[model samples]
Target: MIYISDKAKQKVDALRAEGTLASDYFLRVSVVGGGCSGLSYKLDFDNETKPKDQVFEDKGIKVVTDLKSFLYLCNTTLEFSEGINGKGFYFNNPNAARTCACGDSFAV
Candidate 1:
């Protein structure tokens, strides 16, 4: 299961209200190779769900991931922050073994 914080939910709701995304659009979370730590996280608004996709809903927001990514992201938490030194959504991934300094990438 994946966890979505209230801040994350608010951001998603605001995005949905903009009407720029498809009704089926969801937050896609995935881990890909090629980061300083050997892997990086990718997040985006996506409208497609593949056969092997795993869907999770929390706080009225939907998060989708492929089977492979699911294995690496189970129990992950999505958070959001706002400040002069911090902004945007942050992934608190229990599966990550190491994370980069910028918090944009990680390795399992």
Candidate 2:
């Protein structure tokens, strides 16, 4: 199961209100190739639910990911930070053995 932090939910809602995301859309998280750590994380708003997609909900937010990506994201925590580091979404993935300095990529 993927956990969405309170701040992350608020940010997503704010983005929706600002017209950046549609109400029918859900947060899609995936692991793509090509990053410092070999695997990069990606986030997008999607309306289609593929047969292989795994859907989860937290705090009224629906999160979706393909089955292949789910292997690397199980039990991951999605968060948003606007503090000293900067403002952006980040993933705290326990399955990751190592992550890049930017925290956008990881290796298992």
Per-residue CA lDDT of model 2 for 2-84, tens digit only, reads 99999999999999999988899999999999899999999998999999899999999999999999999999999999978
Q: Which candidate is the best by lDDT?
A: 2
Please report how far candidate 1 places residue 94 from its true position, in Å: 1.2
Where is model 1 more than 4 Å wrong at Cα? none
TM-score of 2: 0.95
Whole-model lDDT per candidate: 0.87, 0.95
Each candidate structure's TM-score, on Cα atoms with residue i matched to residue i, is 0.91, 0.95
Worst 10 residues of 2 by lDDT: 79-88
Model 1 residue 76 CA deviation in Å: 0.4
